[model samples]
Target: MVNVFITGASGFVGSHLTPILLAAGHKITAIARSESAAQKLEDQGITTIRATLEDIDVLAKAAGEADAVIHLGFIHDSRSYAESVEADLAVITAFGTALKGSNKTLITTSAIPVAGVPTPTELSPGKIPPRAASEQLTLSFSSPEHSIRSHVVRLPPTVHGDTDRGFLAHYIGQSRKAGFAGYIGEGENHWPATHVKDAVQVYKLVLENASGSLKGGEVLHASQEAGITLKTIASAVAKRLGIPTKSITKEEAGQTYTFLALFLGIDCVASSELTRRWLGWESVEKGVIEDLEGSGWYFEETSVTKF
Candidate 1:
């Protein structure tokens, strides 16, 4: 069994992922920042380490002891996004130092938006986004000189499932607050998506094959649906809220969606063809629109919590 060290083990994707790893006989050492989170992990028979991202020494020590490390923790604050990115880079650096020349596996999470391409593939070379530095650093550990087996899994904007309090949930909340769902002009800009279940499996698969099939520094895309139009997503929210869907100007989207305005208008389509070919992974969950319309969970709550 693999002795895995994981950050963000109590989070949305991590919560789903831990169960699968446990079922597969893997031992998990998870980082928990709160008593409640620690209790939750302990209840599930996981070893908990109380620490935050800034604890580089503690993170490095944990990485040294584990057979592999999966970093899923990220700060999502928009106001201090640069600081969040800096923290992520520092955390990855600690892991790299601990595992350097050991040939151990290290998997770091990234996003498709950072690819800066119409349809980003595994080999895309642009680092236009702020979070790109972390991605670049994670992959650098895989070079022959460093001797660390590293991989980057780029997630889509919408990792949707029940109990999801992400971007889509925020959009739903905005629709409720405004009494009408709003989208940018024509809403032609697309947002890539994947069900949480499908997304988690990619990590599991990467862990399972890290030593055997995976080459170091590979970038995997977990996006099942390359892109879905914002108009379509807004319409789904509108139908659920029983409100009209309105097309708004980019200037007006800022006032309507608040922090979500910029994301609502970005086109971040991505393809997983290479990832599928390399890992033989397939996404079997329902698509975003289908899940939104059929789940009944997204609209059941009167209040949506922003994540």
Candidate 2:
């Protein structure tokens, strides 16, 4: 069994990923920020490191001893951009310093929206360069820089599934709260997606492939369905909540969802052909629009309480 180290193991993705690796006979060394969270990790037979991802010295020491490192911690607050940058940079530097000369595996999550051209063509590959520049910065250290094995897995906008706490959940919560479901403009903008379990399996595959080497600084997209449009999601949300559905102006969307407004507007159809072809990653995720329309979680949360 390989010994793997993971950052942010108490989060949505990290929580789901833990059992998968453990069941596969891999031992996990996970980071937990709280005492209760650390106890939970221990209960599950995981080695717990009680430190945030930004604690470079602690993280580096932990990472230096592991066979692979999965970076899943991120600060979603855009208001603290500089602080977030500082933290993320520190973690990256720690990883480099800890595994500087080693060819160990390191995987970090990224996204597809902010990487490349607004409308990417078939000719324009989606290796990287989307919403987050962190991919380039992280993978830049591969071989040439620090000789550490590293890669970025760019996730689709909607990581739809039962346990998701991200975009889809927010959409459902707000739609029910507002007594309507809708989108901006023509609602032609696409939201890429993959199931949580499917994405986790992809990470496991990357971990096992020691011979493949992920080519220092590699960026792979975890897109399962590339073109689930926003309008479709709105209609689904409306049906589940028994609410009216329609389109709105961009100004309206901006007002309703201040932080997510810009994100909901980006349309990019990402392809994971490279991951499938190279790493043999196969997606078993149910289609995003189809599943969201049917999930009980949407209707379960009352409009009175915010998500």
RMSD values, in order shown? 1.5, 2.8
Q: Rate the local accuracy (lDDT) of all candidates.
A: 0.90, 0.75
TM-scores for all candidates: the values are 0.96, 0.90
Which candidate has the top score in lDDT? 1
Local accuracy of candidate 2 as per-residue lDDT tens digits, 147-245: 777877777778767667777777777777678776988898888778887877777877887457456666777778876788888888888888998
Residue pairs whose backbone atoms clash in candidate 2: 114-130, 114-131, 115-129, 115-130, 115-131, 116-129, 116-130, 139-217
- lDDT of model 1, residue 40: 97
lDDT of 2 at 90: 74
Give per-residue CA lDDT, model 1, range 1-307, as digits (tens). 9999999999888998999999999999999999999999999999999998789999999999999999999876554778888889999999999999999999999988888888788888547667898889999999998999899999998999987888888888878888899998898889999999999999999999943678798999999999999999988888878999999988888898887897888887888998888888899999999998897678876646555
Backbone clash numbers for all candidates listed: 0, 8
